[model samples]
Target: MFARASEDGFIHDMVLYYGKTTLEAHDVPLKPEQEGLGATSQIVSVLASTMSFPTTTAIFADSFFTSLELVRYLQDHNCRYTGTARDNRIGKPQLGTIKEMEKKAVPRGTCYYVTSDDGILAVRWKDNKTVILLSTDMGEGPMSTVLKYCSESKKREPVGCPAVTRSYKANLGGIDKSHQVLPMKSNRRYLRLFAYVIDVSLTNAWVVYKRDCKALGVKCQPLKDFKL
Candidate 1:
């Protein structure tokens, strides 16, 4: 499977067969009634069960897919992962409450991070919002700047945030955009899946066409025009 983002939206070139193949390779029993698994853990378990990563690889995910347990699991396999997490998730360090932080007036662009004994990096940064991230591969400091909307200035302002956060902001939209544009709604499950596959194929083609056109210094066809 491939994941990417474009004007059309977040797209993943997924094959259902690959999911099944991964499951089979791991000898995962075909049984239900699994309990004591948080929703995030189940998602991570599926990914970890199916895929093996090289030591240099890093996986990035959003809050819904992130947990300290997942990071440790990936680390145990010599892989790295970076992702945002909810404040309420278990196994995370007990940072001060959000309300207390607000009362203390945590400044915009302020960031704090702790490196666990096991070397997991947990960071908290305040922009217009406060976001917490867990990573096995990110440094404890900001190495880049990003443009964010400032309500007081009524304009975009550059603020410094961690490099991992910068990377996440840049690539997080790929899946979201695909969901927005690919309007697949069919009563039959198989038909809906078929349409989704076609949508991904077209999007991937568009990406390749745009890349090749750019490299050749040729005028790129608009997606709408290319669709014709």
Candidate 2:
């Protein structure tokens, strides 16, 4: 069903990374009673750490990541997840098939995926103002948190987190079928990075700064006064 039957159909994988921070709690027990690891833990670990663990986090995986074992692991560790589940995963009328879901109402339960350890989840959907989101987090009765992962706002990446504006003038490379594209200082995350650095350096005087320039990383060019 994923692939295109028509000649012009297209398919591609969707991947994402996100962060969450809001109400925090001290180290409770890394279990259900846990409030949170506070703010820093959310930034340093949840956002930065790449390693997966028992309590790493509960991320709403896409179809490629819909697995019962992964969700159960997060549940056991106090994390949570929700996402568009897969079509396979047999048994359980409550957790029916994808085709069944299309025929049923918007917010219908369907058997989505299973775990290696024999765990299964009944993926459910809910209609918000915009569109309906499907997930296995029916226990919360139905909520909307859209960050591409972990639809639960409470479990999402820390909110109001400062943006880390790091830059490098890397080559987009190859022929664009146009004139040669020369390298230019560009703000990857956003523009104005150099301006920020300039403002900081102007205020500090002693420290010089540049943004997203590979050449500038090793050593910045000394300012030369152009005598008119």
Best by TM-score: 1
126-181 per-residue lDDT for model 1 (tens digits): 77778888888778564667788988889998887887677667655656765665
Q: What is the per-residue lDDT of model 2 for residues 31-144, given as tens digits with 9 covering 90 to 100?
A: 332324333222222321232342543343344444444444445545544444344422233443445446635332222323323233443332221111222333322322
Best by lDDT: 1
Worst 10 residues of 1 by lDDT: 26-35
Residue 73 accuracy (lDDT) in model 2: 43
Candidate 2 regions with alpha-carbon error over 4 angstroms = 1-57, 89-93, 104-121, 126-228
Candidate 2, residue 1: lDDT = 10
> TM-score for every candidate vs. truth?
0.71, 0.28
Q: Model 1: residues >4 Å from true position, as ranges?
A: 1-37, 48-54, 90-94, 143-145, 180-191, 208-220, 226-228
